[model samples]
Target: MTVALASFSKEKLYPPAFDPGGLVYFGPMFDFVIGAAPDGSLSNETGALEAWEPNDDASEWTFTLRSGMKWHDGEDVTADDLVFTINEFASPDATCGGVCGALAANLASVEAVDEHTVKMTLKAPDVNIPAQFGPIEGSIMLLPQHHVEKVGWDGFESDPLGSGPWKFVSRELGQSISYEANDDYWNEGHQPKFKKLDVVLAPDQNTRVAMLKSGEADLIAISPDQVPVSQSDGFDILTVENTVFSEILFFKSSDPEELTHKLEFRKALALAIDMDEVIEAFYPEEAGKRTSGDAVPFSETTLGHDPDLEPYPYDPEEAKALLKEAGYDGSTIKIWTVTFPDGPEQKDVNEAIAGFWSKVGLKVEIVQSEFATLKEQIDKDGFDPAPGVAVTGFPTSNRPSVLTNMQSLMMSPDAGGSYRTYWDPKTADTLHAELAKIVDDATRDERLREINRELYEQYWSIPIAMKNTLYAAGDRIDGWEPISGISKVLSYETLRPTE
Candidate 1:
């Protein structure tokens, strides 16, 4: 059995509606209806489930589940789980807005027609329906409705019930939580190899690092800074390139022709980013390497991987000259960053961008706030996109909320589609409509792939380097491979103890 150890802070666990930071302790205790595969393919890459066909464009999606699966609770996991999950996320009453709400805004209704069948009808066609099934995104691992519906949304989260390889055993406020294997788990025949698992909240990086070093902890999510010294610490390293992209988002609420929308400015900003140095500063030579692709490379669909969009040549002078030509002697640009959990890399990225703009003759002012503060500032009617450079993504559709949310809905949570820059609604709508007209999945993927090109070619917003997620897992663990964000870090059931 695996004896993996992790440092986690559980200020809360949930009905999962409100807890974006989910059962940080019992993550493996749930299963998704459909999953994103390691290669970024949605809907079963693990030899688990087969692709089900869609009946019609009523936007109703039908999934025929693999048979014989049951909840860890020994109760049958029926179509109801899938139906409940879909309705929960689509309902404004849902606590979790996991990224599905925006993409599936056209969802009209959902129903589990039978024990093994689930059907979802949309207000409009959404090609990204399958990608939204995970707990990380909006569609969640099914909750034991008997328990949740009985307790209601508020109470159900505290004592959530689910069917997984493990069961929720005990939780101790802020310190740690533990889970024991479900002896009667439905997948008992599949043979989940571990007997028990435990997660503890160790908020301090140094403390977490020490816990791992001393064998008190077996895994820790790494920061770019911790990777360097972590190299010689005698642990095997696993790198998972993530699908999330962090960029210098531009709101451009005031600048109409968006002179700042120049490719030169985006290119200059891209060029000015010294990612390698920043990576080196935070990660060991072995862990730090430059990565590309508009989003994580794998998710870019072959068409999105445009060589023309490569990282800018690192030349501050060239950048300055470009700005000069644009008549930008460096007007004030607002720089927003998360302060409470400031890692060296996040801080460095902000400072570098600010200083680079300054060198280019722009006045730079730094604004440090937590993710919430920045989000609040950003969601406002007049939020300036140019001022914030938050790391965000539309993992479900590979579309940028920074683009959609701002454009159509004026930054309202209910915005239809657009980025914070609110680049162009008519254009995005046209592109999406064009893709919908194409019936084949391959052709549709190709159509979706053009988002990056349009973002850069049309100067919708600034594009930054796509990143790889680096999680520190001890070599003693096996099979729970870090497959990017393509699924919840492989199923913990696969993790077998090693000596």
Candidate 2:
């Protein structure tokens, strides 16, 4: 079976935690320590972990490995491998982002008690640890210690090995990756249905659609606009709702003189954009749900979501008033918009937002860049060096824990830091510290709601809309289901030919 994706990484594909695009190829080749269920809840059915439990105060967790699990080289999958994986993720030099940041902050120690048992001690009692370790963006996947020790990190990157149902065959730097069925895969029920899998990168949506029609590709991920085209062509279009949210993240400038440091300026920018019109112009009704005050896209069903919270009303005049009240300096604020694999229309949406800001007496310049360039900038120089505000997709459904979401995005640099930082360090640290210690479900829920309310009022970020992920598949493929609550992670094991 063949699949076409929008983008692929040029770098060597090891330490899978760093690159989302790399995960498309390497994800099926490795198993996670924990897995998330269809509804974004914790599950042990899909990973190497057989069972786990928290101690009396919840500060410590013990995990038991699944019996008889073995790597592709026939090495037994044990607690030592899990220990090595966690330590690598927590390493200070690791390029991993939010997920590793959370682990480093809370994990006091992780040790293999026996061949099948591992014990983890935390700095604080956190119920969200399992969710952070699940198979989601930035989450750690179990790595074979023996292979890495033999090959070294760089060697492992060139030739990786895992215990997943699919084994890595070969990959072209920027074009494609191939895999073959692991006949000895531990999970009997979830064994690979097909012998070979090929994933190719075709950044152009039109080309991807054409490939699908021409029978060159069995499955392709399509954007919201392509829904009609795929539907009309009679292709099976699968959608996963509330997978991610389009958000305008405001970066705190190091210099206090910058306009970005002012909360009034950020609030004015938020109030200026008309999300309803933006949604209508660029997105399908099913894919575009206008977000309210909360930075994270949380529905009523999502934990810690406040349903009573309403969206900020569109009032350009009020935005102008706020700008004037803050002593308008006429400084040009740049809104950086990058091309995302899933949401190609982000540039158009950002143009509309820039127009709205311009009408509110603000000097707004829309700077368009590729996602790779922007990521490189942020990696070299922190968030402060980038544009004041950036339009990007923030995944929420895949991360069910609200505390984990906040810790990953809102915390300061000193406190194991977040990938995106906009809040006051002292306040954010205190709230996160307090929330992390709560063991009771009721108290945790209330505390989470309070934090959301605080962030909502503070204008942490501008939430545009919750986006639904859409995938189009041809008739040649069968028995494949879109992984719920996940945007790009594909279950290659369950995929089989129609015959």
Candidate 3:
């Protein structure tokens, strides 16, 4: 009844093991022992985790395990599979991990206790341990030991065997991907109702929308400008807040004489832009509003979001004055935007932000690049010339216990996430000490908040409006809502046909 339209960049189906980004689609198909919903709510939203505990010390974690769960291959679920998978995935020789290196650091070992029980002991008492169990326990899909042991974890190329709701049917690179529902899925409580799903690799929005309108595709991610057409086409519109944002980058160290590090200069630009207008110009009704910090929008944890943290709202006059006080009359700024094909409002949004600086006497130059290009560029540039400004934000499990990530970003040369603020010894020592604390969750969260506050206060990057992570379902679809900052997009079982 409901047909959903989605676009993929390349038609290649790589092994999920080596492909971290590829997991985005495969995630909903597979299940994790832990996860988040689209709303930023926990799968066990009540804060009641049936499998693990948040209050426990990082040195020891107990997974109570779900009863009667089985892999897609009909292998009886056991604790040993989890232990085997964890050790294999987190091991250093391999892992398509964003956090596996760090998660692996704390994990001393993973061992099965009983048939449905596994325990993890850490090398130290970690305060931010719950962060490991991200929206889907912060790891990718749990691998089935039966298959991976034979194929080898890293060698399972193009063969994605999992205990997920959908099984891979066929794939044609740069063309299409088809999957069939798993009738034997153990977690039937959260399985998809659809018999089949197809993901066509069409990067152009015009092409995608055309396919949707022509009924060649049943559902498509509608652009704000195309919302009317979607409604006219009788497609259901779903919009929700997203943690993603874009920004102006400056490798200030490259030009120490530049105003990139000047607080007033940053504040002026922040105050000059009308983000609401940016939202309107690009996103219209489907636009998501931003919060004070880079925290996910519409989070349960964002209830106390400081309403007073005001953004500069198109006051070119205020912006001009701020720049003057900072001794910045006018200097050309090179701005870069990272975008993916078929992503939302990308060009208009980037252009709109650049326009704000231009209005207030700032010379702005824009550079745009594809996802892979951007990452490659960043890898090459690193801290040598930090992006004058770059837009980046990740989905959160609960407020992103960012200390672990922040510390790693700031300190680890290997990980080299943009925390590359070259430092005086005093500044370095102070920030490092704050990061190395071993404490309880309550204490750790407080420290983490302070770190986030400092990052914003220091004007590391301008906090643009939080965009909504959206998926368009047709009118024939029901029981779907764009959840808040909760992790994971949709439960496969939640997709019931409307008509």
TM-score, prediction 3: 0.82
- Tens-place lDDT digits, model 3, residues 147-193: 77777644554676767777876666657667788888765555667
Candidate 1 residue 216 C-alpha distance from true site, Å = 1.8
At residue 326, candidate 2 shows an lDDT of 70
Greater-TM-score candidate between 2 and 3: 2
- Runs of candidate 2 exceeding 4 Å displacement: 253-256, 297-301, 372-398
Instruction: Give me the candidate number with maximum lDDT.
Output: 2
lDDT of 3: 0.54
RMSD of each: 4.4, 2.6, 4.3
* TM-score for each of the candidates: 0.82, 0.92, 0.82
Question: How much is 19 displaced in model 1, in angstroms?
Answer: 6.4
- The candidate scoring highest on TM-score is 2
lDDT of 1 by residue, 299-400 (tens): 343334555555445777887776666666445666666532213355666676676566656676776665656656655777655522333222222222
lDDT head-to-head 1 vs 2, winner: 2
